[model samples]
Target: MAVVCSKGDWFVSSCSSTLVSVNLKQTCEPFVFDCAKAEKRPKETEGNNKSSEGGSKEKDSDRILGFAVSSSGKHIALTDDHKRLVLFCTEPTWQCISTRWVVRRGTSLVFTQAEDEVFVADKSGDVYSFSVLEPQKPGELKLGHVSMLLAVALSPDDKYIITADRDEKIRVSFRQAPYNIQAFCLGHREFVSTLLVPTGHPDWLLSGSGDGTMKIWHYETGRRLQSVDVRQHGILQNSDADTEKRFAVSRIISSPDGRHIAVQCEQFPSVQIFLVNSGIESCLNHAETLALPQAPWDMTFDSQNQLWLLLESEDINVLLYRHSEQHWKLCDTETPELKRVTEALQAQANVYKGSVGLESQFKHLYKVTFDNMASYLQKKQERLEQQSKKRAANSSKHNVGGKKCKKESSPVAQSTS
Candidate 1:
């Protein structure tokens, strides 16, 4: 559910409901917020041992399936199974102030950068946008996809909206012109799990499907930029019949720099990093799997370019993967023995093809205990500074408004006196 940057200053929300904040600048407390307690309990606990794809939403009523954070880090949009769209202010605290039920069962929520509009999609494949600034007004647009909406994403420029669905279709539509459907990118043979539009590239869309392949498409040209068969790489293709999952590609993300694309391999417990070349080719081989302490179902990179993996199963371990001295290392809260097992496996050939010297970093096996309390405290201090800046901005605006109001009221008060 949460990924923090390397310096431990910034964080991002994952599949979890609450925001995880860290202050790396201080060493007293690095992480804050209890997302688990904030979530609504699952409907049923029967067969609690059941396993699902890494990113699958738990049966808990409070679990959030799809969410999008604004580029400016000022707002967050989230959706639940009840077709509710909840908007929260990111500064000061994670407060859910705006809530609206768009459909009987909503699937995804996205927002435009320049406008106050927030988009919500449901299982029916229909998309609706309500103004976050004014939720009571009628939604600006209503459009339909060819199939059930699996995921929804707003383009980098917030000009277009793209949706991937069960019918293996990706539909692109304008944000302002809701009645018009721009184009459909059709190629996937199975259900689509995720869709991503890189930060600076609005014309391109990256999609992952149950078909076990990640495809890059040029939305403007309706062309297939490239397609990499994720299943054919590493341990993915070797899945036994007894271990097969119902869906695939739980999550996909384009790195901040837009040079690489990392995709979660369904229930395979691994992540594949591909090189985003001119034609969307994979730079790493089958060994590019970034192995987690457990099967990683949800993941994201922080501002420091560190990998934060969230496990779906009973193993509540949140592992942090950092790059130092030219090799990837793991930072975890597991036992020394368990950490050793992870290091041994990660250092194996089947994990990453091009490298091998990264295991020495694990020899220290740092634990998240009081001894390392300084690391966490440092992170907390940084968050305090960010919060302070937000408060300052609000205070300045309030003071300016107060002065203007006083000036305007002077004439009225003089006449009354």
Candidate 2:
């Protein structure tokens, strides 16, 4: 998974037990830290030993759950499946500032608006907050839910802490005093996978879920303003229960200008775009749909609002699309640095293998054909329309000539009589 920082840097979570950093210019550097080797608190080792004993030498606990970079882009916090929280400083060098162990495995991580504190939501439905200013101290439990927390975020002003759980509920609580519940944005039929607050629109909240819908809400009042069903645009049909459950909306990203929203679903190659405006009844107007070569694993918009899509394929290429002339166009140019990063990730992926390699290659080839077919159909439609217009013009001329001949023949008949 690739996470775009506020400063336009990329943090890639690798399965090779490392985190890679790509700078603004797309230069790749390995920020190596082995959680297995990191020193843990005395009490934390017992749980680690037990988890390792029950699983293979490669425990899932070693994998990273989530990570986030601070607003200043100076610090980063990441959580692993082993309930280990590691904070790093990205300035002079990528150094691990501190390592704090949590009670349960974390599902999501986010830094506060001021970047002074970082919050981690765990599988046990509890939110823990650790002050970045103090690295040695343990994290304090903030708030929790009855169900597993899937996502969390803070309001731009840091007024409220919003959280979502597997039960399809989004809770808004006071940032300072989380016990005082503010509101619950409840409308999702399935687990809420992601939450985002638009840049300029602090009052509005955007959420994507397993229900195949993206909803816009007024976070303060907990009002459901609109819901857009994105399944119609993709191959996932709502009627199929298995398909609906499998193809949930994985990510929803808003443009920097807050005028457009981009949505991606799991295993879907198509990216849906929506327009945001006050008078709009539903944001599902389908402003534009971009067909990607591979299903996107992650996506983000840069400072210039150019959409970047990271494909989940063998090559793992990043595609950039820019809006031009009332349409979204893919730039054919590839930066050398970006190409190098893609090749590096691809090499890393090849180290792990299964029978799916051949199948994925075929899928990529099919996607190319699909794209060409779409272009061919579009041109074919235009040609057909032009031929229809020509036939209509010729028919109108024939009608005018027949009318003139009828009039002349009528005058001749009258004179003979």
Candidate 3:
């Protein structure tokens, strides 16, 4: 698992069961604590034994399901497959601040807007909030869903809590009173995998789903403003009957200024960029489509809007892209720490599964195909618009001529009478 801090530092968990912090210069050092040696709650151990008695097995302790860094860059949190939640401090050397066990394995984690609290969503569809300042205290249940919760986010002002579940429902509820649901954004045909509200646009919500589409929603009114068919952009092929089940939108993130949105799939070498504007009709204009050398495992943007991509290849490298001359250009500088980590991971590649492989036999499609299809669709839309305008203009001219004839005939009839 990998997370990028606000200050452009990267906190990545390696196969060695250690979390390493990489600074801007690519220097990497072991984090203060080893996650393997962290103490497990007694209750969690009891639960594990009960599960074993019931013929169920416990998950690997080293598997990290979710990881996140607070927006302020002061706090970092991660949840492992053993149902353990760990928090750490980034400054004055990395230190494990707190470690607790949740009711179930967590799937996602997010910090509240104020940075005072952190929310953890488990596989059982329950959300719990804990005070960041007080690590010893227990967490309180905030909300829940009947289906498993996949993603969660907070409103900019902390007024509402937005959550997406496996049932293709995005629920908006009062932050203070989660039972009082404000609205539901429901249009995806399959499970919703990701949810995001742009940095500046508090009223709008962006969602991606297994249905191979990304939708823009007016969260307050539960109205779907726009739907972008991501499958058309080479994420999936139309000939595949199981398109809905095969491809899913893995991630969607907006730029810090909320001017650009980047989208990615589970196993793909390309990232789709969309330009956000005021008008809903054109909010998802395809600004640029970039193809990378390797399939990207994760991506994030820094304060300066530089796009950072972590590839899943054996050569560990973070590709940086900067907007220049109306296009995203790759920077020439490469980090030495990326190389170090890649080499380390490569040496131990046989000992452990290093977070980079596809389970299914999905053929790799080219980005040029998607670009060509987009261009064709744009031209087809333009042609249809032109034809409609011509027909409207001809109808107006015919109406004018008919009125002129009627006036002439009326004068003739009056003279004859």
Q: Please, what is the TM-score per model? A: 0.64, 0.75, 0.76
Per residue, candidate 2 scores C-alpha lDDT tens digits across 1-417 of 444333445434444244555564555565556565765556557566456456435344465667887766788888876667899888876789998887777888889988889999987799999999999788899999998898999999999999998888999999999999999999988788889987778999999887778898989999998888787775553343355234577788888788888888866778998877767666435788887777776777766777767676555566777888878888664655446545555555542222122322112111111578888999999999999999999999999999988987897778988
Identify the superior model by lDDT, candidate 1 or candidate 2: 2
Q: Judge candidate 1 against the unseen true structure and give its global Cα lDDT, from 0 to 1.
A: 0.60
| Model 3, span 136-243: residue lDDT tens | 777799999997788998888889999988878899999899999999998998788888888778888999887678999989999988899876775554253345
lDDT of 1 by residue, 1-417 (tens): 322122124344343344333433323222222334443423342223133223336443544556676665667666654434667664564566666544335676777876487777776678878777785464544788755687888877777888888878888877678567788899988777678887556677888887767787888566887787776665545555334433366677766666556787644567776655653354323335675545564677666566666554443345666656645577654633234323332332231222222222112211223646887889899999999999999999999999989987898777988
Residue 193 displacement (Å), model 1: 1.5
Q: Give the distance in Å from residue 166's predicted Cα in candidate 1 to where it truly belongs.
A: 0.9
Model 3: worst 10 consecutive residues (lDDT sum): 360-369
Please, what is the whole-model Cα lDDT of each candidate in the order they appear?
Answer: 0.60, 0.74, 0.74
* lDDT score, candidate 3: 0.74
Order the numbered candidates by TM-score, best leading. Answer: 3, 2, 1
Clashes of 2: 0
Candidate 1 backbone overlaps, count: 20
